[model samples]
Structures are given as structure tokens and as C-alpha cells.
Target: MKQHHVWTWPIAGYLFLGGLGAGMSIVCAVADLFFGKGELLGLAPLGALLCLCLGSGLLIFELGRPLQFWRVFSTQRAVLTFGAWMVILLVVFDALYFSFFSGWFPWSAAAGARAVVAVIALLLGLGVLLYTGIELSSMKARVLWNTPALPVLFALSGILTGVAGDYLVCGLWPYGGPAADAEALAGILRPLMAGLAVATVVSLLLYVLMMYTSSNPTGRTAATRWLRGSYALPFWLGAVAAGLVLPLLLLILGGMAAALGALLFIVGGVFLRFLTVYSDDRRELAGERERLLKLPHGDEPFLKSNWG
Candidate 1:
């Protein structure tokens, strides 16, 4: 079978970074709004900002004409354009929220203003997270990506990765902040990480199973590749074992094991993006394979000879 290379590593990187950053912002906002731990988890939003910026760079790099990226915003109707706006708005809000945490302004001390910023950041963050999945699922020609299950799975994975990132930075980093606050935050994140891990695993399994059993042969082929074909190793080892299961087990064990698990989860998140992106095979039309098979091979003598 011919391989599809339209979207590759750069796109995958954008997906991973975008989802992770958005996830981080969502977690931080929630902690701040309801739990009063937003200040304690300040590093998350900063990290989120860095992630979004890096993700946006990767996105631009993936474009044929990187300088023409502004064209994405020229039309307000396309999903990509909407996503671009989401990222921009997310960056703006997340930066403002981070500024408050960083104590850049005296007004940052105001709880009311901080809460409002957090709320906007949180909404925009969720929009970014959902956009990542919607972006792929919107591509109808790619049977493997044209499913509602995809957005749900991606959203779940995004949140799980975000929690893992938070646990690593706020919970594990020695210089993250006050030792007491770090310990407290770690305690809160531990169980949350485990729960998210379990949920992600379930969501992933359902997504793959749905694809494997889908009516579309192309979708099934993609799922088979992940399950037991060429992509199986990465799917099983990188995403399932290392990313979800190992992390869950380590989180249960507590101490340094949980930290390692958190890091593994992030790695797994990256693998997930690559696997999904690469598996996006377009649905084959009737006789498409036969038609291609009849085409002259590059090495054929007739083709090798110059027509002129």
C-alpha cells in the first residue's frame, strides 16, 4: 500500500504541544477557580504559554508557505481559521493569567480580577483542546479520522497529558515554588492523574475498537495497523504501556515512581499524536488499487526513455 505523507511529524508535534498546553491551562484554571490552588499551580499556565507558542511555531513550520500563515485568518469560516483564532486567544488569556501569578502588576493581588482572567483562560483553553481533535475529524476523506469518537478520545488524552505535566512541574520540580505548596499540590494531583490515566486508557481502547469494527475498510486497516500490524509496537508500548498503564501503576506506588510515571505519560502523549497522524489513511475508492497497479513503474523501460 502506498503511504500518505500529506501530514507528518510537524503536524503531530503541533497536535501534541497544542493539546498539552491547552490541557495545562484548563487544569490551572480549575485549580484556581474552585480549589484556590491556582496560585500554587502557577507554573502550569506559564508552561502552557510556552507549549502554545512552540506548537504555533511547529504549525507554521508545517505550512508550505510559512509566511502566508496569516491567510488562515483571512476567512472566518474554515476550521483551521477558527483554530488559529483559538490559539491566539488562548495565548493572550493564558499570558495574562500567568502575569498575575508572576506578580507583574500590583493589581495581580486582586482575587476578583485574577478569577475573571482565569475564567476566560479556562474557556479559551477548552476551545483549543477541542479544536485539536475537531481539526482532524473534520477531514472527511480520511476515514480513520472522520469519527465523533476521535474528538472525545483526544479531549480525554489532552486533559490526561495536562494533568501529567502539572504533576511533573508543580509537584516534582524542586524549585517550582514553596515546598509545602508543592507537596500539597502533589497530593491533589496524584489521584487525579490515576483517574485521568484510567479514563484515557478506556477512551483509547474504545476509539481503536470502533475503528477496527467500522464499516469503512480504510478505517479498519488503520486500526489493524495499530493493533497488530506495522504500528502495533508503538501503539502498545509507547501509548498503552508506557503512556497510560505504567503511569497509572507508578502513580499508585507514589514517591519517585509517580514522577517517572508522569514523565512517561507526556512521552506517551507524543507517541499518541504521531501514531494517529501517521495512521490517517484516506478511504480507497472502488478499483483505486487496481487502477494504480496498472500505472507504469518508474523503472519501466518505456517510462525511463524520454518522450521528447
Candidate 2:
């Protein structure tokens, strides 16, 4: 079988940004409706809109033919084409809802209408988040992406990064509220940061563990790449240390320290996306290598290449 390295940094950016946006939208909606954090409401929509636009733009540029991007909308094949449409639709809903609430749209007073748009956009955002994982998993050729845990891992990470992003933004711009309000918001976010960070860490462990235990040689090779291979240092330092552990510890300190944790979480999220894209064992499988070695140097062990 021929291996294809179709996804690159652009796709990785799309995945990370889309999840970030979706997570922020959901967090914003929940906060506004449940917690009455009026000061934090605007951040969610604005963040969602910004993320959707930027992420989708990267995806379009990645396509290499922007004119043909519309083809994704007209087609339906697993989550590939469907995901493209999801991004577009979420952007529209987020934009409309944002404009309405921000006074850019005249009919902003209609609470019912605003609520409807917000709900649709939030659902679409979540769909886009899950789609990132589903799309990757659909690529049967990538051994590391085949597990069910991948989507869960991504969804958890998305929510984790989303909450962290919200914490950072709210800390910086308290939406005209006093310093105490920012402190109050931080108080709310402290526990959340710890919980989400823990979830992301646990989900990641299960993902790697699944790959490690797979009976397939390709799966085993992919796991080994992270454990003690070329990708080991970055995986541990960037994804686990910076992204998961540091953020959790910082949040426990609270106050200004949580803001730093949020920053690290964002960086960690980006690194995770980059590593996942680059670490795939798209090279020839171990079984294929063994077969080729047997065919080319049969009965002559000294002549066989030590490529393994």
C-alpha cells in the first residue's frame, strides 16, 4: 500500500484553531446563560468568529485551489467534505450572532432570535471540534489515528484550550469591569483549569496506551515513535510537560499565575497539533520493510540493509 502525507501544518492549524473556537463558543454560551457573566459573553462570540475565520482560511489555502473549495460543500464522504461545510456554516452563525449582540445588527433586541443563532453556532462549533478527530481517524492509512480515543482526546483538548483561552482573555480585558471582577472570574476559572487539564492529560495517556497495545506492527511503531524515538523529547516536553502538567500546577497557584498557565496551554495545544501531524508513520510499515529485506537479500544476512 502506498502511504500519502496529504495533511501538513495548514491542516494542523485548522484542527487546533477550529477546536479552540468551538470550545470558546460553548463556554461563552454556557457562562452567559447559566452564570450570568455578562462581562465575559462578548469574548466567546468574538473568539469563535476569529478562530473560525482564521482556521477556515488556512484550510482553504491548504487546498491549493481556492476556487474548488466549494466542492467540499456539495460532497459527502465520511467527515472530510462534511467538515468543510461545518466550518463554513459555523462561521456564518457565529458572525450573525456576534453582530446582533454587539449592536452591529439592528434587530439585536430580539432575545429569541439571538438565542437561536447562539445555539446553532455552538452546536456547529462542537461538531467541527469532533470532526477534526473523526476526519483523522478516517485515514485508515495512519496507524496512530485509527483509535476511537483520538476524537475524545481532541474534544477534551479543545475544551481544555478553550477554557484556558477564555481565562487569559477575561483576565486581560475585564469587559470594563473592575479589578475585583477579574479576580472573581479567575476564581471561577481556577478549578476549571485544573479539571480540564487533568482530563486532557488522562485522555492523551489512553490514546498512546491504545496505540502501544495494538497488535499491528504499524501501531506499535507509531507508539514507539513517541515513547523513545525521534518524537520523544517534544512529545514529553511540549505536549505533556508544558501543555498538561505546567498548566495544571500554575492554575493551582491562581491569581497572575493562572494567566501564565493559560498561555502555556495555548502553546501546548499548538504543539500537540503539530506533533500529531508530523509524527504519523506514513513511511513504509515494518512488515513491508521485513518483506523487502527478505526478497532482496535472501540467504545472505550480511548483504541485508540494517534499515530497521
Candidate 3:
């Protein structure tokens, strides 16, 4: 019956950054393979590599003993261990992919090797994305996070945010690409981002609906909190309106509106991760509340008397 915090901003930051990094890697790989936009000069891949590295750092920092992070590789059965390896491999491959684009070494000129590296990095990136959601959903005690919808929702949001990030980097950074190339990339990415935004909206709605109607009372309570309780303002305004709807409208408007929308999308993605982390309410067992209430308060006279 003892109250304990589920998770905090550090965990949320790891989740958000992990997903965003994975998403950027995916976009980078796809662009090279399909659109022939290798002219991006490896900025996207480098950004993704940094994001994953930073996210991994946050996870390690959250551990009780941060110095023993290498112990994560000591076991293969644990989900966290698997995730750790996934991140390591993704980072390695992503770095290689970036080196190819950046021409960091003489071997970087090999197109076949670069393509292979990109594909591997892309797959590993996806695994990292799924792992972020699965890490939470596997905890059955938190009914709000136990559903399959969570991974799907997380994946969609990750990709959306990743595209937004790519757009922003290409727009703001001088080294991103030539002006004409950036414009062309934006033209291609605009419609893709809008579609992803729509899909994310649908996925989010479905997730909330599933939680609200779940047989588990805890799940319903969590959903209710987001719908009409203390979390409603952020859920409705931050996540839904500014994060999703407004972004969709801006994408439609194009030009400066599109850039602003991308920024909002990134903000909204962060908001979603934080809100989800904070909203994890555990399921209550029968008679647990009553038993806790019957226990003496910390400030009770008997406890204060120091009769020991």
C-alpha cells in the first residue's frame, strides 16, 4: 500500500531521445536509399548518433550505480540487457554510416559498404524505438503501459518527431545541404510528415480509448486522469492541439508555418513522453488501502514518545 513514484523525467527523457534518434536514423537510411539525398552530408546520421548516445547516458545516470553500466551486457535474458546491446550496435552502425557520408576515411567511398551499414543501422534503430515502449509495457503492474497500443503509438510518434527534426536541421544548419536541396527535401517531407501526424493522432486516440475501456480499473483511472483529471490540460492542449492538430495545419500551410509546426511537433513529442511517464498509476490490490490507512501516522504520539 505504500505510495511510490513510478518514474520521473530522466526515464522520460531517455524514452523521448531514444525514439527521436531511432526515427532520425530511419529517415536518414530511407533518404539515402530512395531519394538519393546523400548530399545531406551525414548531419542526420551524426545527430541521431548523438541522440542515442545521450539517451543511453541518461539511462545509465538513472541507475543506482552508474559506474556499473557495463554490467548490462552480462546477461542476455533481461530486456534491459537486450536494449543495451541494441543501442550499442545502433550507435556503431550509425557512426559508420555517418563516416561514409562525411568522408571521414578513405574507405568511405565504397557505396556498397555504406548501403549495408545504413541498412544495419536502420534496423537497429527500429529495435531501439520498440524497446523504449516495450520496456514500460512489459511492466504489468502499470496497466496504462501494458497494452500493445503503446509500442505502436510510440513508433508513430518517434517517426513523426524524427521527420520534424530532420526538417529543422536541414533548415537551420548551414551544413545541412544546399538551399535548393533543402527546399526539395522539405517538399517531399511535408506530405510525409502530415501523413505521419495523422497516423499518430489516430494511434493516440485509440490508445486512450483502449485504456479508458480496459477491464483493469487502474487503466481506466489513468485514462480518466488524462481525459478530465489533473493531466487534461497538457493532454488536450499540449499533446493534442499544439503537438498534433496545429502541426498538421502548419504543414498544410507550408513555408514558415511548416518550420514552426516542426518545432511544435518536437515539443509535443517531449510532452507526450513526460506525461506518459508521470501518468503511470499502479493497480491497487484488495484491502491494501485499508491496511495502509490503519497504520499509525509518522507524527503519531506513540511514535513520537520514543518508547524503545
Candidate 4:
């Protein structure tokens, strides 16, 4: 079979930015709604709302036509179903985006709307993870993506990548409220970093475990792009060493070490996306082509390649 590489850069950006927006939105929601942290007042949840909206917008437009995106909600079923949840999230995200950009936020009445949307966005933000999980799970053709663990893996990857994206944005975040205080921001950042690092490791283990349990060629297929020399350098030295191993050790240390660890965690998360999409076997894609051109789905007989 001919092995080939396909780039998923735009979708990668969508996945990365969407996850980050959703993650940040959830964090802000938890901070604002439950703990009653007023520091979340201005741009905190707003930023998350905008980012998610922007990312989701990109995704809708990222498709063949932006209008076709509405096909997700044109259903006759009840609204609480998975499709409903998706549609709801899209609407809620859109509202948040429109309201903020239109300068509706500072008004006294906007507070109530913000409160409601924040809670709903939090729930849907979590759904973002499941949405991604279902995306891969629904695709039966790509066996590697067919595992029951795929949804969970995608969820963790989303959260991990999202948090990492948040940290990377720290370079741009202007100081204010909790973020203004260096020590306090460091404190908040450390725990988040540690949590994400732990999550990333767990995700890796689950992936391997899923593969180990599978006897089918579908489950056992390899995406060697990550294991090869060209990709291996950044993936291993940068993503693994700098992102996981080094940050983990520093997290063990404390102080500036913890902060540094957070940076590495973000770096690691970004590359994890790179590795996942690039290393794709897509379940022996040539086989799919053959099935399209030669054999039927259940047919076993096949023609030999001319190269052989």
C-alpha cells in the first residue's frame, strides 16, 4: 500500500482554538458562577465566548459553504439530543459573540444575560469534548478512529490543547484583576499546568491500552509519522521532553519551575494534535481506494499491485 501524508492545518487550528475557547469559558464559568469571583467580570468569560465563537465560526466557514453549517440543526427531533446539544451550543456561542462585539455587555441588564449564557456555555463547553469524541466515533471507515476510547481521548486532548493554548495566549494577555498579580497568576497557572500534565499522561496511557487490547488490524494500525526522524525531533525533544517530562519534573520542584512547566504543557498539547492528524494511517487508505475501485466491502479477493 502506498503511504501518504495529508495536512490538516486549518482544522488543526479550529480544534486547537475551539478547545482553548471552550476550556477558558468553562474555567471562567466555574470561577464566576460557582465561586462568585467578580474578577471574571470583563474580558475573562468574554474572551472565552469570543474565542469559541470565532473558532466555531471558522469551522462553519471552514466547510464548503458557511450556510451549510445550519444542516446540523434542521432536524425534527427533540432539542436535548446530541444534535440538539450541538445546535444549542452553536446558538449560545453565537449570542455571546454577537452581544460582546456589539458592545451590549456593559449595560446593567446584560449582567443577567451573561449569567445565564455563562452557565449554558459551561455545559455546552463540556459538550464540545463529547462533540469531538462523537465526530471520530461515528466514522466507521477509519478503524483507528473507531475505538470506544476515541471520544474520551479526543476530550482530554481538547482540554489539554485548550489549556495549553490559554497559556500560550498569556504572552498577549494584558494585566488586570487576578491576572495582573504576577504571584497570584502564577499560583492559578501552576495548578492548571499540573492538572493538564497529569491529564496528558493519562491520555497517552489510555491510547496505548486501547491499542494493546485490540486484536483487529484496525485497532493495531500505526501512524509512524510521529515515530520517524523528521517528525520525531520536535515531537520527542520539544513535545515530550520540554512539554511533558521536563515540565513534570519542574512541577515537582515548584516556584518558577511550575510556571515553566505550564509553558511546556502547552507546547506538548499543540504537538499532540500535530502527531495525531499527521501520523494517520486512516485505516490503510489504499484499501479504501481499492474497495471503491475493485473489491466490495466484504469481498476478500484482490488484485496485486503493479509495483510488486
Task: Return whichever of 2 and 4 wins on lDDT.
Answer: 2
lDDT tens readout by residue for model 3, 54-142: 98888888888999889999967877888889988998888888788766689978999988888898799889889988988898888
- Predicted candidate 1 versus true structure: per-residue lDDT over 1-308, tens digit per residue: 37447799989999999999999999989988999888777778889989999999999999999999988888678888888998988999888888787776888778888899999999998999999999999999988788888888888889989988888778432234568877888898989988888888998999899989988788888999999999999999999999999888888888889999999989999999999899879978799888878766666676558662
Evaluate all candidate structures by whole-model CA lDDT and list the values in order: 0.87, 0.78, 0.85, 0.58
lDDT of 4: 0.58
Ranking by lDDT: 1, 3, 2, 4
**Model 2, span 202-278: residue lDDT tens:** 88877887887888777788888887787788889999999889888888887678789988998888988887877
Clashes of 3: 0
TM-score, structure 3 vs. true: 0.91
Residue-level lDDT tens digits of model 4 in 1-308: 33454436555555555555666666656655775542423344455656665656656765777786766555555322463355346446635633643454664346577577667767877876566556555666565566677667667766665554444444243324444553444356567766766776777656745664566564554523334545667666766777677888887677666666766766676676555555445655445766655533433343334333
| Model 4 TM-score relative to the real fold | 0.69
List candidate 2 stretches off by more than 4 Å: 1-4, 75-77, 171-174, 282-308
Poorly placed runs, candidate 1 (over 4 Å)? 171-178, 294-308
Can you give the TM-score per candidate against the true fold? Answer: 0.92, 0.86, 0.91, 0.69
Model 2 accuracy (lDDT, Cα): 0.78
